[model samples]
Target: MDCTNSKSVLKKLSVALIMFMFLTLTQGYQISFADSVALTNSNTVTVEAHFTTEKIRDGFYTSLVVNYNILDRSNIKPGDKIIIKLPDVCRDIKPIYKTEHFSNCTVNGDTVTLTFGPNINEGVQGYFTLYMYGNSNIKNNQNYEATVTIGNKVVKANIEGVAVDGGDSYPDMYKVFGTNFPVNNLGEGIIVDRNKPVPYTIVVNRGRKNLGTMNLKDTIPNGMALDTSSLKIYEVSPNNNYTDVTNLYLNSGRVNMNYKHLQIYFDPGNMYMVDYNTFVTSTESKYNNTATMTDYYGNVQGQAVAILGSGAGAINVYKTVDKKNIGNFGNQNIIYHIKFDSFGTFLKGTMHIQDKINPKLTDIKVTGTNQFTVKYDSATKTLDAVNDKSTIEPGDNAEITINASMKNVKPGETITNTAQVNGGDTNTVHTTKNPLIQLSKVGIDNPNHLLSGAEFEVINADNNERVSNIVTEKGNTNILITSDKPIKFELPYGNYKLVEIKAPNGYALNTKPIDFSVNANSTIINLTAKDNPTGNIKIIKTNDLKEPLQGAKFNLVKDGKVIKTGETDKEGILEFNNIEVGDYKIVEVSAPKGYEISKDTSVKVNKDQTSLVNIVDKNILGNLNITKIGNDGAKLSGAEFTVEGPNGYKQVVTTDKAGVATLNNIPWGTYTVRETKAPIGYE
Candidate 1:
């Protein structure tokens, strides 16, 4: 047969067999003490047939039958016994064989034994059904076996089943009922709100046979209410198609609502089904729900459970600076606000707020919210906010305001503070005020043409030490002054010095520092720098012998350079004009006839200043020759004469064989001669 026809035939056979079994198992059984029977399938065994548990509750008496097909087996025995064995799943056991083929069954704790009767037919094909009281649910999937013995061979048939509704639930193909949002599927923790109803889609998948007339019931936990209008049911086809059946389902007064319970009926045959929507509200802190689907046979088919809880509220702490700018250093005000926003949920816990104040500030004074207990740590400069009352219910917004101060701050400096809410989120606020310093550099001669490219250094006026890293331009440690632009600095208000470290090309450096104070207001200092004017210098070359040396050469050296070279005139004077004002050296390069050059002399020229360099070049004199005569005027070779001159001059002369002695290159002054040693007879 084709697959389609084969499936259709199998389905028809399965339905017929399910109906027959359902009638046989549930027809005569009546639970007298209980209102209804909670019969769940205990075991199923068949040959060349499919079996399933359908419409049966747990912990109920059920019937199990073993069918034997004896067409092929012909042992040809009339007195042989057929024994049947039962598992531990059944209690209060009894056996029934209508054909008189088996009888006299007895049960042990976990074993059941059966014996064959004498009326057993030679060949038979039928069922031997066992009646037993049901126990509590099984722990897990377990096996139940029935056996028959023939000579030395044993034949057994087995059925596997599981416990249900007795502390055990496992994934099984026979069971149904699930949800779109399971607690495990929704992740850990119950994070939901009742005022805001959450949706959970309940689904009932297809089973082996048609489950007739199922009643869906929901038991809501305390502090919760369900929305009746949101009840919806959808018939899901085999192709996963949805057809809304809520109108038809609820039209027959199928809904039965109690205080916290709901029951609705749905006739879901062998097809997928679903309750599309339902909403619930929780009035308390948490909510729990359990829903079940049961058939008309009083058998639970599917179940779903969930738990949800309202989350905690959020905390926000905002801080702001009161003053736009802090003009002075001490005692500035800052405001803070702590808000506990419910965010549509209730909160009950301790609220914490801590503020780490700027170390530059001190003496924290709580100006607002005197109900809060304030603590300060001077070492860390922290302020803690602790409320006396800690509990906050749902929809409760508790707010606290605080005002504090900052100290020891200066102009052009920023003071910042931060505050945290619930020891988590933090916010920082700051205030700053700057002091200005303006420096104007100008030439003394021309104030309008201010000094450009004149670098000035800033120093501490108290110690006269240079300050670093404060500059108006890159690559410069000092502030450069321009003709039209004055140098300015934003600094903390205090005492500082502006000193001209490098002057313009020709201007003189101002060595004196401009001492100034930066107070609340801005200050401007107009510094004046001067450039030296040209001056004249005259060099007078006079001989010590009271004569002017006309041919004397003079060199005027300025900064180690010969600036002017000139010879003295007839008056023994040389003059240079328009010489820059600075230190200059004048030297006689050459001397006149019979005159010696003088030493170099240094002179400093000031603005429009004239200075004279009186260099005296002495005139060289010729040697005086003297003769020591004997009686024959013979040369006195051994004569020594010492010549003494004016102005602390002295010399010595010797005589050769011609008896001559002379003194050379002496000054033109009167002198006396004396012979310390005389020749043989001359003195």
Candidate 2:
């Protein structure tokens, strides 16, 4: 509000004074803002410039008196100068600059929009441009919201600033407008509106006598309380109106200027009030994607029962649609309506009707890339390009791919993918399980690139084991699996045991076991031989000392022929089955008694290993003796007796006789007692 001494000699300034003041204050001293950016959307991206910076000049929409900073380090302009540049984008359509923003960084225009790019390959990216002087100067180092040309639309960002604040030395906060008021008068620093309302965030010291303010009025009358929490100033001013103010509470004990501290105008009819009206008419709003906008204002700031007004002075509060998926709750909205018909008259103040119809935070996009974190330049408003690096083991190739899992994914829908590796890779994987790859209008419909698929594979490794059966599924992007022949696998090459699928194209598939092995403990396996033999065949488990196998089977064969089949019982004895009594070979067809694994490679019907073929399995108890003498018989336990058996068999056993003795299975021989122990009964 350049309400300075321009009125110092108000009623009595010489005609010369008026002329000099007008020349110094409103001449061709233009404010130009540019956003110079070097970007690559592969090369560049489009841009859109919205108006929210230190408001542009006073009257002519473009000739803005920017006080707040928009393109610097802190977002608050501390100086009165700025530089902006936009990306050099190419468009199929022409008529480069919008109505006001021509290639020539025009002086005082309301809006400016230019084009940047849609890279030769895809889209675009770039910068903004700004220029200003006076209270609206682009301060030294402050970041401001800016816009650029993108394909057919405008892209925007908080373009960083180049260090241009206090010329020679770099200071944390630069100063351009009001003089720095002393501690005692901290609050006395005149708040001005340089066409562009300067965004001021004061951090006041505690326990200090805070400063006070008096605007467009003469005397500080009695009982006019100046409570930092609430003020009685509205009563003093003629029109009594304030745009904004911070609340009464302290921020971490410090008095923060959170918009709650704004005071109503002392006199709405003041020329500064004229400036305020202009700010209202040219207001540029940012609807936070909701359907309505909310702006809170208070008069009688210190009073409990003050009626609040909206940005355009109308008194209705608007809410957003509660259809939740669209973030209806935390929506920011605004609508501005204005009528300057009676703007300067005290009596017509009531006739200067105004109202706003703006979008709420719910109406604009709050999705897509939500929050951005990056290194940026203070003066240039350019995002610092970051360099990244990585490495992999020998004999490996690294690939990074992006993908879109579905063809036409709905906005906000979750997505998934499937991937694999041909040449083995050892690189650690970054993946998503049923990763909620949410979809947005910009990125949906992209092909599932290799990288995304690989990541999906990494995440689904544990869950995909059970997916089964794809019935006649086919597509370049669709997963598929089929076997020309049964796939076979085994531990030892030919032992074909199992088969499986590593990755599916589109449809999900399950794993299959192709081949398996078993421990065949089969005994008496069939080994048939055709009969061309001339004689019977016999097989044995042991030499002459033992008979045939206790539980063995055999087949007489002549050239692998089975002449006859026979088995041995628990007793080591077997017959010659049925065969010609001639030269013939005996083959063990079944497992033998008490034998783990043994083979009779080839056995002829010849004499056994020890001949005789007499070994039997019957238990034959050794020699026993019977002795008798007269009437008395003796039963001896420890004496040996010799028995004479037919066939010249001789044997011995301890005598045990009571006129009768027993012997077990004495091999069909007749025996007589040749010797007796102790001359039994005194024989």
TM-score of each: 0.31, 0.22
lDDT per residue, candidate 1, 1-683, as tens digits? Answer: 00111122122211111112222233322222112111111111112111112112234334444433332222323444444454555555544333234434455554545454443322222334444444655435565554545444455545444554436433211222233231321121122223334454455535424567766777655645656666667777767787887778668787787557777776657443444233443332234455677764555533333333211121223455666465332345655555443222212223456777677665555532433556767688666766544333333445555555544665456666656644343445667654545566665556667567777777877677777745342333545454557665544556787777776654556677777776655433344444344578888878775566687898888878898899999998888876667898988888886677788999997656678888887666777887877778566787888888755777788788888887667666678988878887666
State each model's CA lDDT, in order: 0.51, 0.24
Q: Which stretches of candidate 2 lie over 4 Å from their true place?
A: 1-43, 48-570, 573-683
- Residue 408 lDDT in candidate 1: 60
Supply candidate 1's per-residue lDDT for 513.
74
Question: What lDDT tens digits, residue by residue, belong to model 2 across residues 74-185?
Answer: 1111221122322221111111111111122222232333221111111011112132222334333555554433233334434223322335542111112122311111
**Model 2 TM-score, all chains together:** 0.22
lDDT of 2 at 328: 10
lDDT against true structure, model 2: 0.24
Please give the TM-score that candidate 1 achieves against the real structure. 0.31
Q: How many residue pairs clash in each candidate?
A: 7, 146
Which candidate's lDDT is highest?
A: 1
